[model samples]
Target: MPDGQSTRTAMFRVKNLWIIHLLGWVLFMSLPLTIVSREPSAGFPVRILQSGWFSSFFLVYATLFYGNLLVLVPKLYLKQHYVAYAAVFVGLLVAIYFSKPFERLIFRNFRQEQGRELRPEPPREGFREGRPPRPPHGGDARPMPRPNGERAVDFVSLTLFIVVWAVAMAIRISREWRQSERRAILSEAEKAHAELSFFKAQINPHFLFNTLNNIYALAVSSSAHTAPSILKLSQMMRYITEEATENYVPLEDELACLENYVELQKLRLNAKTSLDYEVKGQPEGIRIAPLILMTFVENAFKYGVSNHRESVIRIAVEVAGGDIRFLCQNRIIERNREEERTGVGILNTQKRLDLLYSGFYDFDIHNDGEIFTVKLKLPGR
Candidate 1:
């Protein structure tokens, strides 16, 4: 679900798909090499050699097919050079058509040479007598009649050339479509990240001001906890400055940041407010969006804590089987219940989860009269 991983996966899939395409073409091409004729004059190996000669011509067609995909599509059609694209494509097709007969001539010459090599004439029977060899009945060896298979080679080559051209064009077009869609998705995600960053930037200043105020009060009161509180605040600030801008951070680091924030909040909250936090499993090698859980924790502190009334906030995180589950529950202050739904922090968190996890996670929130709860489940590691 991280940003670059999806792009790499898509590229891998496309590469595999094209490999399958090439293998299918190769299997189809082998038919000509294996199958000779029902009329049984030449052996299959001889036919295969003949087909190999024809295959050499198909090699040129294959080159053109791949060339059009890798070169022509990008340089001409995709670049909006429509007239040039049309002219070049038609020219290639015509050249392939004409080259078929040219190659057939070459195959015929090869067959003639092979025939001479394979079937030398027996010693002339009449040479022993004095009649030089009454020429064959009607004429000297008329060119051996071409086989039906050899005659069909040119037509079949042309047909395959056309078919391959069409297939290459189709694949190129589909690949372009997939690339464009990927670009659009990435663009939308970048826009969302920019907007979310701006919102988060706004949140940091306000949160720092509030935490500084709490620290100031503790310092003025000369409480012994002031030094450690300032140290905690420094650590949290360092984390926000260094790690928060990245796409993801170690889950344990994020949880440590939360612990620091909670400790700082404890310096300001009444002793009567009950806050319970627990971690249920190991967090090694796991990662999550930075500060994603802090919003809910901050909300709980902001609205659920009271100096006079007994208030409770509980947070728990569970990690198991490559899944992470987070739960935060707090009893709300009677008067602040209505305003809970509105905050830049909560809204930004929702947008981020949608962009990053989309189909890979579940998020839920509920306000049941007296208690507000948030639950998040997402893939880990």
Candidate 2:
């Protein structure tokens, strides 16, 4: 089935073809009389005009049989039958050439046209002594055979045929151009979706492994706070398992993950350690990519707070001016002199953010004295 565009294109193609053919037919059949006449005498102009008018009268009839055959091809033959097409085409050509103006009263007042298949009154040749037949109705008498003039007709009509074919070819080209553009857009979307899915895969596994490691550490210590640590870890897992499937989670869900992570870390806090945090966003309806915020919080616990004797952790996040602004700072108490700085977790988290919010984020990392900070600003209304 054709869509709206294809249907419209097809209709235009049909109209264009006929317009080309009609213009060509008029120009060619009228040319000798209307434009190319070598006549200096009025009589020649009148004769050409009569012939041109005669040919113009049968234009549609000629198209009904011949033009349709050219366009519809063998379909026309199958419908009208091959013999019928040939017979009508040949008979019409012969009639245009040989039909007598007054041939209707020769054989007992019954005069008919003459052709290979037509029978008219036998020629009255001065009653067989070389006179042209007395055409019926006694209006005139003439004897002549008009040639097909096939070369002239072919030169004119085939030129019009080529124009029609060119228009159809143009329609096909335009349709393909549109289809190609649509395909290009779809391909670009698929590329983006694949990039996002890879980012998701990279971040999720890194997150789960880190959380499991925290659980392992608590399990090894076997402190009185172990049960609640296990509970917090379980809640974090629930958040991951449920919310990770979604494209975006509520901003509060991200805040809750950070809180759970902080609670679990509290079970292991040294007496000198301190944590400071604030969340001022409208957490109810605001949405964020799943697990986006926790990476900074987790980094605070993993690098700065985990290594310090009396470390400081500070977090501030709020929706300001239609933006989600996040900041995390912790003391980098134990800097390593010789080690790779790009951990798998941090690297994966960076990629996930790049995919999710390509230009919508501002991420900065800085270490001032003993404090390390990850500052992020993202946009959502």
Candidate 3:
């Protein structure tokens, strides 16, 4: 994908996440409005909104949710500060519990201001017998009992706090996992790209060295085909420097490059060295990894040619139904010390194949001390 498109996609995903969070919080906060108990009357929603207890509880839960999501989970829990994180969590829980009394006081005062009692007062004892209520003497006044539903309300509120904390932690952990996976995928892609470039660097110079040696031999012998060989070399180098830099090139272009290489090699061969190169494919719309087929062809020419002894090299390519089949066969021959040290191109090409194609392609090599054979099958682009 293009950089601009990728950036736009990332931004779109971020916006979607924000929208999801906003909707989630809205739905969560609206649950209380649905479950609130109140007499049917005008402005019921407004009265509930004006209640100090409702507003206080809403604000407290919202603060706890965001604080845990943004600060506590990432900064403490994810950083492995387990003891500190637990301490902070317990502190917040205690603080919330202690604030309940303040919430009740504010609600009670709000009800008094609205000309209503927080709850109906119990009947006075001995009042039905026409006896005057005894005045509290000194510090002997009895304390009122706690409300019946207060404990249940506190239990429910504390449960909500725990639920919110768990939700925030789960969300943060899941997001972190997704981000780590993305980073790993990107790192792997970059490593493969770097390795492929290194392999190409190795293959390019090695190819030039061998091709130059062939051209040099022809020129030293004052052969008539030397100039034509140089022209083929120029075309091949143009393809390498220009089109081959891309990961994949048009199949026709690769075939043209291979033909140039074969013709260049032919300029240095004798009658005793037999060569056959054939292509049975219409390589128009297909594409292939650049220079992938060259290493095997170069190997054939290097080890299959001789001026004093009979040798054979066969190369073929067949393309059919979104698949390509390539074959190279050459007779094995003894090599000098310098030639024995020169299989870097083949090794690098093998590595490149593994990096680029992996399971998508099949490659086979066989050598029986007389004939060396290579067969490769690749899916088309």
Candidate 4:
């Protein structure tokens, strides 16, 4: 993806996150309006809103929610400061409890602003006028029961505070986990790219070294094919320097490069050597990793060609549906020390296949005394 497009996508997600949070808070703070009273004359819902208690409660909890999410969890809880985190958490809880009186004060002031004086509720029906009712046994007067609504409100406040804290912790922890996962994925990708580049670096020089040696042999012997070999070498070099720098190239371009390589190798072949190469299926829009198949083809010519014995090299490529299959078979011949020393290309190519294709591709090689064969299947785009 382009950097600008990725940046825009990230920004869009952040904006959506903020919007969702805003909507959630709005619904949460509006809960007081949903409270209905059996006694309509009590005006429970309107009184709750007008008293300013719910507003103050919402404000404090909102601050705590964000503070815990953005600061406490990240700076203390996630860092393993358990003792300090517990202490700070208890302190916030105590602060919330103490803030109840402040909330009542705001409610009182709000009522005063509306030109209404706050008043205590009248005693229950069992109580005499301005006098407490006696207990049935008359040992000691039983304490009057508190109103259910008042008890429910206190319980709900504490419950909501704990709920908000848990939610904040859950969100922060989840966000941290996602971030770490993203970092790990990016790190793996970068390492694979660097390793692949190192492999390509190895393959390029090894390929050039062998190709230049072939051209030099022809030039020294004054073979008429020397000039054409040099021209093919130039074309191959251009493809390497320009197109092959990308991770993938058109399948046709890769095949054309292979054809040029085969022609160049032909300049050194004798009557005892025979080469058969074939390509099937339309490769017009197919794309493959650049130079991925070159090392195997080069190995065929390197180890399978001999002036003194009959040698045969067979190569075939087929593209069907979304799959690409390649086969290379060559007759093994005795190799000199120099030829044996140049086995790095095949190893490097195998590593590249593992890095780029991994489980998505299949590769196999077989060597039986006189014959060597390689088969590879890869997914194409």
Candidate 5:
């Protein structure tokens, strides 16, 4: 889905959930009072008007409900301000107690109104001798007797309040935990990307230093192939500087880069050295991390080439069945003692593969007596 549309859908669902909670609370408070009362079968609306707990209980409960959800839990409880949270909680309870008289007054009036409407009195008679006067008819009947205000401070309300508070806290904490996890994941991804970029940036200087040395040797020897080699190097450098910085590049571009390096090396190697290169399958639309294959090819030229004996360098790239395979091998005519030091390019490639492909790629290196080989397989991008 488009991001905007998905976000809007999510918001709509949240709104519906809020509406459901509100309706559910209303029914929860009103249903029992309607069912258990002895009054005649009044419609739901009339019953709600006469209901004892619905009016002020709902008011007080709702006040605390949202207060805890929006304020108390987030600002105090979640912050581990337990003492302050408890103080505020106790204050709300005490306020509920002090609010009892008003709730009773409202309940008494409602009941009286319902009573008068439902049950009218017969004509009143004069008081009997030695008896107090009878209470007046409907207009002035004594209000329903006030029940004990202390009854308001019972276990049921307290338990229900606790349940609501628990729910609010649970919801708030879960949301915070999820948000924290998302932030952590995002942070990790950004850090990995920055590291990969650093690795890529280091490759150009490292590879360029080696290539420049080869160019200097060719320039010193005054080889006729020197100009073309320099041209190829320039093109390769342009590609690296311009396109290699991207997260991915066309697979063909990397293959071209490898070809340039191979041709440059050919100009500097002895005629006895034989080099074989092959590419199979289309590279169209396929993208790969840049400079990933260059290190092994550079290693082949650096330590695998010798003028004293017949040397062979083999490089192949294949793309088929939604996978890419790269292989490079060279006969070890004479190893350069200086090549014992592993270059930074190889280490950078390892780190880049881990950051970008993780377990999705295969990298293998084998060195036996006569030959050194490298093979890499990657899933299609």
Candidate 6:
């Protein structure tokens, strides 16, 4: 396998084992030195050269064991810090017990067998050849295993093992922390999606309520076009309820909705008030979020039509290929706080735009003391 693939596979497989791995590595790294470092003064580092891939057996098993302990320790006994520490301490002893017996066997047996293979050659510095080695008693002529400083190695191995365990546990703990953060971000997104759906649902009832009220007024006034009003309303209602739920709706359908809404509003208003609606750039089939433009439309009608004064609502939409621009401007009446406060509905609409468009939208809201203006330009990617 390639290096990256091998590392990834090892990471997945070893993320769960613990103590058994610690014992295995301690034995693997130490065994070669004990066995093959026979003639320690022979000027050859046989422990390393001869260790070979057999050492990897030790590496894989030992790392896995240490990793397992890290996960299991914190998961099962986190609140009981003292007990977890105790279990670790006991596990250490058992690991050494199973692993220590190998040191003596590795050194003593491999060398003894190897020495016998090339016997009677007076093996040199290791056993003190010929007359045997000293015993502080002067009564033997047999070759014996040389002193390879086993006690010193015992201290070194134990110290190194403790250090390895500490480092391995830290890695596992850090990985756990990152996984938790990913889960938290996903949960927040789900909540925002639900909130957007709820806000989107509110627009339907508000639009219906206002439109029905206008139709009722026309009926009472006995206008000649009441039938046309009801028919326009049916079309608008069907268009909104059936199509707006989709991700995007044709710009023409949305404009038709706005036109129907304007016609409905005109029935209540006298002919002197002004409204300008324009579509520049042949923006017929361009798509947009359902009802994204409706809030601005409703706001314009609510505040722009003066009962007996000159008032204007100007709305213009321009679409060209992948770009769309919508501009809504209304006269700002200083004394009408209720109509101005209804402007807060724009906040919910702005939030939806942020979620859906992100980098693709430019929205500007400004009031130059007389005119309240909103400009939004969105580009498709």
- Best-matching candidate per lDDT: 3
Q: How does each model score on TM-score?
A: 0.63, 0.54, 0.83, 0.81, 0.77, 0.69
lDDT of model number 1: 0.78
Kindly report which residue stretches of model 2 are placed more than 4 angstroms away from their true locations once superposed.
Answer: 1-174, 306-310, 333-343, 367-371
lDDT for 153 (candidate 2): 30
Error of 4 at 335 (Å): 3.4
Clash pairs, model 6 backbone: 16-68, 17-68, 18-65, 18-66, 18-68, 18-69, 21-62, 21-65
lDDT of 5 by residue, 18-82 (tens): 89788868765664354335564557456656666556667767777778888999999889999
Q: How high is the lDDT of residue 139 in model 2?
A: 71
Instruction: Return the TM-score for candidate 3, rounded to 2 decimals.
Output: 0.83
lDDT of each: 0.78, 0.64, 0.83, 0.82, 0.78, 0.71
Query: After best superposition, candidate 1 residue 111: deviation in angstroms?
Result: 8.6
Error of 5 at 357 (Å): 1.6
Which residue pairs show backbone clashes in model 1? none
Residue lDDT tens for model 2, 1-381: 559989999999899989976885566455433423343344644443455344443352355435544443334343557786566545645553343211211111111112322556675545655554467788755645444212223333333334443454354446557888999989977876787677667667777777677678877878677787778878888887888667688888878888887877776667677888788957777888887777778777767654337778888888877789988898876657653243455676677677678887898988777777888888773
1-381 per-residue lDDT for model 1 (tens digits): 987999999999899988997797777556444442333355644654466565675567668788988998888888999999889878876776666633464446555545665666687766665445656775774455656335534665566667777787888999999999999999997897887787678767767776898899999999999999989999999999998888788998999999988898887877889889998888999998887898889888888888788988999989988788999999978665675554566887888888778789999999988999999998985
By the TM-score metric, which is better: model 1 or model 2? 1
TM-score: model 5 vs. ground truth: 0.77
Winner on lDDT between 2 and 6 is 6
Cand. 2 TM to true fold: 0.54
Candidate 4 wrong stretches, greater than 4 Å: 1-11, 30-47, 94-154, 336-338
Task: Report the C-alpha lDDT of model 3 over 1-381, residue by residue, as the tens digit.
Answer: 999999999999999999988898777655555544344246655676687666776777878889999999999999999999999999988876766633353334434444452456676875566554565665544656755324424554566678889998999999999999999999999999999998888888889899999999999999898998899899999999999998899999999999999998888788999998999968889999999999999999988887777999999999999888999999988888886766575778888888888889999999999999999998888
Worst 10-residue lDDT window, candidate 5: 101-110
Model 4 clash pairs are none
* lDDT over C-alpha atoms for residue 57 of model 1: 57
* Order of quality (TM-score): 3, 4, 5, 6, 1, 2
- Using TM-score as the measure, the top candidate is 3
